[model samples]
Target: MDDAIIRRHLSVGRLTILEVLHDEPGIDEDQLLAEWIRRRPPASQAHARRLPRTIAQLLWQLRNLEWVDDTEGELTITALGEYVREFARLHSPSPFASRTSTVGGHSA
Candidate 1:
């Protein structure tokens, strides 16, 4: 996969985690994992098993990107993260566009 695609997945993962935390601030890691599994039921069992590591990786990436701030067991989305999430939503692919290949530059 392209680095950009990986980056986008990291961003999306971070955004999803942040949104979950926003809904229930001060959640512990286990709670976070449970919530993620509940939200993304289609995720494979292996994926679910690896969620903690994945989330940690995403969190680290988000921290490096300045998209989140954490201290003393509390985490919060930074202004940059909020802006990115909003921008992503605004530019999200249309559901009906799947028949085309404009997205991600795949010609059909």
Candidate 2:
């Protein structure tokens, strides 16, 4: 299988945030952070506590890429973001394609 498109990007955090935005557009920072924390694996929950900083950094990158927009306190994916997200899903290795997909080429 081919590598994920994330290989060409800054960090996995960037790809991760974009995936969340694509799934739940117009979510505010708090909501976004909460969702991210909630989605963390049980074993990762402790580390997930640092998600705010990570989310901030990722949001910066996404904004710099013009892939996300913040308006009226809500975050939403841009046209480019949708395109990138879709392209990544279609072209990334099956394991990394979908947000809910597991490592063994199956949905979680």
Candidate 3:
């Protein structure tokens, strides 16, 4: 997949979902949504109520990308999903990178 398309398919929220899925395979939607809600900052707690809808949309997007497999009410990360998760981990910007060196140690 094109890097641009891959990046476009991921946002902080979606990437977070992917990461969680990668870590916990076969997690049900409800449990996944609850976990996501629990991770949100207190100020964003208001959005927790919308987790069901948000997670549905995110899962749908990931499904379209073939990164996630929704089987019998359980979501599993596909091989592609694992690849994207690692890609994001490697490419995501770090707070200290801009001030000092890139996460990969290249001068930013």
TM-score of every prediction relative to native: 0.67, 0.70, 0.78
Best by TM-score: 3
Distance from true position, residue 54, model 3, in Å? 0.7
Candidate 1, poorest ten consecutive residues by summed lDDT: 99-108
Give the alpha carbon lDDT tens digit for every residue of 21-62 in model 2. Answer: 888999999988888766543246555676688788788778
Deviation (Å) of 12 in candidate 2: 3.3
Candidate 3 regions with alpha-carbon error over 4 angstroms: 41-45, 94-108
- Arrange candidates by TM-score, descending: 3, 2, 1
Task: Please give, for residues 1-108, the per-residue lDDT of candidate 1 as tens digits.
Answer: 333553354344565776777676667666777787776553467876787898788777777877677766676777776665555455555412332223223221
Off by over 4 Å in 1: 1-11, 93-108
In the order shown, what is each candidate's alpha-carbon RMSD? 6.3, 6.1, 6.1
Off by over 4 Å in 2: 1-7, 42-46, 95-108
User: What's the distance in Å from true for residue 67, model 2?
Assistant: 0.6
Pairs of residues at least 3 apart in sequence or in different chains that clash in candidate 2: none
